[model samples]
Target chain A: MQPGISKKRRAYILLMRILMWLSVALTAGLVLFLVTYVMAKGLPEISWNLLTTKPSYLSGNIGILPDILNTVYIIIAALIFVIPLGAGAAVYLNEYARNKKLVAVIEYAAETLSGIPSIIYGLVGMLFFCSFLDMQTSLLAGALTLVIMNLPTVLRTTQESLKTVPQSYREGAFGLGAGKWRVIRTVVLPGCVDGIITGCILSVGRILGESAALLFTAGFAHAVHGFFEGLNSAGATLTVALYVYAKEQGEFGVAFAIAAILMVLTLLIQLAAMLVGRYFKKRRDL
Target chain B: MCLPMKKRQSKIDPVTGGSDIRPPVLWDSLMKKQAFENFIYGVFLLLGLITVGCVLLITVYLIISGIPAIREIGLFKFLFGKTWASTAKTPQFGILPFILTSIYGTAGAIALGVPIGFLTAVYLAKAAPPKVKAVVSAAVSVLAGIPSVVYGLVGMLVLVPGIRSIFHVPDGASLLAAIVVLAVMILPSIVNVSITALEAVPQEYEDASLALGATPTETYFRVSVPAARSGIAAAVVLGVGRAIGEAMAVMMVSGNVANMPSLFQSVRFLTTAVASEMSYSSGLQRQALFSIALVLYLFILLINAALNFFLKRSKEA
Candidate 1:
């Protein structure tokens, strides 16, 4: 307590400190409430039947197996297309580009792409992939739209890891008569494997959570199909299914079940990201 | 073997050495290798340009599709018109309600979210012990990772009902509920970015404040916060962008009706307006939806530019 300080100022500071602690407590409490509430409401409804079979109108049964498979298919498809383009862009920007202005423009474009809303992506995706390209609201069009949306995420992560590769390593490889591309393939590419993996996990989490960007691009169909077949046909992932069930069909039970599954997956992704970060840190130290 | 062959070749060259008179086969092979490397470099360059191409494509598509409706509706009526009756006989295309709802919704979310987020960020970054910080931060990340639709679901189940019961409103899906959901939705970005900014404040500034007889809280608020103003501004701006752009969660809770925004009344946001009607809309109505999206896109672009400006200033400072 300073001799010159007033009691009112002391009260003000006390109030702020209390409010800060309260806000932090509120945040933690909200998270706990959401997870527990969704799981408690949803877990009992999830069954082997729900996990394995598609919905049938004749039986009046509702299942999310198709949605789950659709999610997996879209994730796989988007990652397949996104990784090469994203990592290649990152490599070029970090390793090959000499012009500062061009690099800045590319980076700015990536930033702009990321900031655009998912609904906007859905619209443009609907126009370009569905109408113009005549893909017509298939999972493939949805996945392609996500390719553009997640490109910045993958590019950023790969660029960060590429930056961590030592210049000395590149010099050593070149000293051994390796060409530039050979040096990149042997040294730089290997070093960024963790980043690419991390990016994949992050993008998967995003794809799992996405709904607005998929609704128009991937129409809501419940049929389960093979990978190529699914890509060419209309389908709904879990998020979209959740929206459809809760908002359109009034099936809170099915929506809650999907929400619970997504919550668990979200937790897993967060944990994996933390572990991967730690592993990379420890490796760098060693 | 390569050294002996090179030596033999050099001796046989008699008048000129290998450097002056390389074999045509070797020269051709080297030229091909150089060309191949150049081709690979060109491939990578093209890959980099793909991102730029995507941006161009999005911009061009939005503008081309977005212009016709504006041209037909007249920019004034489309932008400032109060009614949004798209399906009625002699349909009206006013989007003032949507625009105002978005503004109010985003403002309301920011008002509610920023204070709590800023305070929580201060506690986490400066006051909390490492273990507590880790746990709380993890909790925040989980909150963030939960999808927007999940937020909408939870809001529909809990917050919507809760508001209905508490306020005795006929339908709890109103601008207030949307604001509440958006506030919670933007919390993670606000907290995470603010924590980074607050932590980046130089330690000596706080230490000096403490040495000058200021309390820790006082030092943080008076000294640390002022130093991190630009970053905090950026965080707020990021929250604004998120709250405005959010569609699914808002659509789920906001009752999806075009109305002049009153806190307790059902209203449509700019995002929900575009999303709700895009599926069934036809002809000029569909074009109007594109025009709505164009407006939203422009808003986002402006926000992005502001974010970049703040981020750059923070880095320089």
Candidate 2:
């Protein structure tokens, strides 16, 4: 449309613009359709019975309480192990590392771990944790596998936050005769709480959505138990249960109900991450 | 001078507790504290190396558990075999079908997904209004966050049936269905990463292009996109990794048949081949499943190296 533009150039520009608009429309339309379709078909199937009890063949009743409990147990166990390890690695890299080669190697390893697929993780977890360690196919074994999967997330977030902490703070602590351990424990660790919390939310979302990694390590059983008992016994989380109910059993109703629950949880986790990130960013600015 | 020295001495006294603490006691406590610090430092160093240890463990275990079956089956047959009937009497364990299906499926997804994702990223980064960009970006994140199983469920219910009716195929669950689902599943990553890359292009370059009488769209495509080409390449490679590694979503729609991967035929990918039979397999079948996983890992390693190369280039640029 510009005065100097030729007919061919104008046609090319017009075609590119149309393509751009069409792509945006298609992408946005797909998201809208998926959310509405899942919600409409899924919300009606959720009920009090589905949330409170276990599935029983005698009465042909289906429930998700056990799966919910198993999911919670795995999340708790994985977090307990991953937090300390991930945070410690971040601290060591930022505050204590003197060898550049070691730092590069550690970073590369983290990247490689993230790139490996969940199915491979499942295979290795089955071989190493369930068989080699003799943990059996239980929630604990699944949780241990997830700890490795999520370590890179926690490390990267904590490292980013660590970089934002001022160097003057560390110098002041040392000036007061504090040792390296004391300085990190008192000054550096506290500053990275927001990052750790954000990482946790993201990891929880990934764990909730995971199925391939859990299928082999955590066998599917619809029994309910206490925390320690649950870790010892094999169980299925919500995602795995959805897969089994839909693919093998052809139980579409139960699968949809579970999908709806996961959708809501994913949205909530995203919102919480955004809020935590904004709150910390504002505080840091001040 | 006497007065200043007296004041300084008083100040030092208050801090040192009037010199009651002898040099040996102070030195001894400092040494203990130093040792304790070293101990804590060592603990952190151990933690840092755990990631390295994990990577080594996965590699070693995959090779150890994944090789016996290959050695037994012959490496050529294992890699290039055309059949995968692990449960059949006198099982045939060639994985050529799986290898081809995975490659074809990933290529299909990339072919369908990248152009759309790239155009959307260009629009978002260069042309869209702030409100539209924010809304679309949030939608994209939601797409990313949705569980892959939900995508599978939707595809199974809607896409498979729709494809069956429209295409008049006997079985709707085929390689085509898997490719469609995967294209949708990979859209978010391509769009999000490309948007980041496009946004990183220096504004001065665009301004110069515009000043030289190029249109805004021309400037974006000609000037900005070239500057961020490496990042965009990295994004496409990342999408390839996701498409190849995906198991459950593809499993639900692809019919899980070990065919040679025609668009309209049921086929099995490497990831699904391991997952579908792991529950009931034993002996050579189980070890062969591990071998399949090892092959998938090699594919991922190659993709990771490519991703790192592009990412490093982008950083330097």
- In model 2, what lDDT does residue B226 have? 97
**Candidate 2, B1-317: lDDT as tens digits:** 11112356456542355667657776677657655776887899899999999999999999999999999999999999998888888899999999999999999999999999999999999999999998999899999999889999999999999999999999899999999999999999999889989999988999999999999989989999999999999999999999999999999999999999899999999999999999999999999999999999999999999999999999898
TM-score of 1: 0.96
Worst 10 residues of 1 chain A by lDDT: A1-10
Cα error of candidate 2 at position B264, Å: 0.8
Which candidate has the highest DockQ of all? Answer: 1
User: Residue by residue across B1-317, what tens digits does model 1's lDDT show?
Assistant: 11112356446542234347667876676556655677888899999998999999999999999999999999999999999999999999999999999999999999999998999999999999999999999999998899999999999999888889999999999999999999999999999999999999989999999999899889989999899999999999999999999999999999999999998889999999999998899999999999999999999999999999999888887
TM-score of chain A of 1: 0.98
lDDT for every model? Answer: 0.93, 0.93
Off by over 4 Å in 1: A1-5, B1-20
Instruction: For candidate 2, list the clashing residue pairs, or say none.
Output: none
Q: Candidate 1 clashing pairs?
A: none
